[model samples]
Target: MPNHLVPIAFELPHITLRGLTNNLTHKPLIVALHGWLDNAASFIPLLTEVTDYHIIALDWAGHGLSDHRPPGTDYQQFDYIDDLHQLLTEQKWENVILMGHSMGGILSSIYAATFPEMVRAVVSIDAMGPITTESSVAENLRTGVLSRHQRRAKRSIASPVPLTQLIDKRQQHTELSGELVELLIKRATRPVIVEAGDGGTQVVWRTDSRLRNASLIRLTEQQAQELMTELSCPMQIIIADDGLLAKRGLWQQREQWFGSAEIVHLTGGHHLHMYNTEQIWAPIAAFLHNIST
Candidate 1:
């Protein structure tokens, strides 16, 4: 419930966006990006475990309270980096720590490599693999369009429930404390729902289609290798044992990007961090501490 936000102009004078930030004793900044379909609340448990580093958690365009996608334009995954770039420009924080989950994780990795001098360290929660698992760009686009279409339909008509009620709904999907759940609920839903169901109403969308579509441009293995080599700061990679990788060694060989890097393995599926924060957050804390000191 300690999350806070203040509206700010990001790219254009007329185009302002909400910048979400988390504070714990006013520590160093760690810009955190949530995974696909998730908001900044995704980092709550991890944030609670850390006593150092102020966490900057963001909602991707069309995801959380951030500005929805520009009229007819679909979500562009690359633009996420651009958004953060504008944020850093406005906030005037360079060579800061960056951490993210899933899509956000991939984004922080890309930015750290792209802006080596501006990033002091980068952490990928579970999104630092080769961009595409497919062979054709057309196929990628096709896949993206279908997924995005579904997401748009869902979010566009999602109904709002009372904050407490919304948290109950989210609990159906995950087992989080009631208080933590409330924090997430308040950040996502509005005060009213025009179409509340008889006993309870459903939020129109649980996921964003634009983000799925934006990932059509995947990096080839060669391209990924090149990006890995481009990283100039400290880096940390955390992979789950139950993740989608066919082989873990692929990531092991890519650590050449940083002057110093560490790898840790967690047990569970892609979302082990959310489901098992107490166990996995330890190494992440150590990694960040070492980098900042």
Candidate 2:
């Protein structure tokens, strides 16, 4: 039988935004975060193996079921971290294990560093620290809403992006099982406003793309080190063998930043572990088992 996570908008009474929370109370508390352009459901495949922990996965704003940004809003890196900060500040979770992937990984790194006392451990999948060196940064900012006042026009953020089309796209990159695909389809998207020439409204993705703006919050080597300087718990960094971010001096920089942290490189692309949990779950499970004990 599928374990159904309770459906409730984990909302702070004073806050307009909310997160989807699941309580695995019998297990250790774990906060799992998905990658960029993905949602809470991304962790579904690994959910079975991680029965020891109560995992709280999140749908970051504008990705899954969360709220979209105001027109011309920059999906700034800092904004993502701030939302997490809000969650941590309002909740009473203490020393919970933290796991995040891609952009989520970077956000987790920042959160653990800033609030060392609250984290028990951290698992960063294929990323280390903040992303300030991406070439796309300047390009996105030029056309993106965060910095530029003008609405940068694009021909097609979602060209032919029917749900069918997105599934096809995901298929081309990785081999996914039917059940996994269904779960991803459920959590990864919402209907978007599309001008399909009839002038009527059509639903599509906001864009399955990352930000192009040059990140204002650049990280130097020292700042990276400072992020992990105060952590008193075990640290685990999971790097993907094929992920470009892992190859681009990130592992080295991340190692320097997170002094004394355990590093493990696994096979797959950036979302490899999430897509194919059968193969990738072993190391992750072993790590969690070793640490939780």
Tell me the TM-score of each prediction against the true structure. 0.76, 0.77
Whose TM-score is greatest here? 2
lDDT of 2 by residue, 33-147 (tens): 8877667777766765555567778777676666666654557777876777677767777887888888888788778777788888888888777765343545544544443
Model 2 global lDDT (CA atoms, 0 to 1): 0.66
lDDT, candidate 2, residue 137? 42
Residue runs of model 1 more than 4 Å from their true location after superposition: 2-15, 24-26, 141-186, 194-198, 206-209, 212-216, 245-260
Off by over 4 Å in 2: 1-3, 13-22, 71-73, 134-161, 173-182, 191-203, 206-214, 230-232
Per-residue lDDT value at 179 in model 2: 56
Error of 2 at 48 (Å): 2.5
By summed lDDT, which 10 consecutive residues of candidate 2 come out lowest? 147-156
Q: What is the lDDT of residue 225 in candidate 1?
A: 67
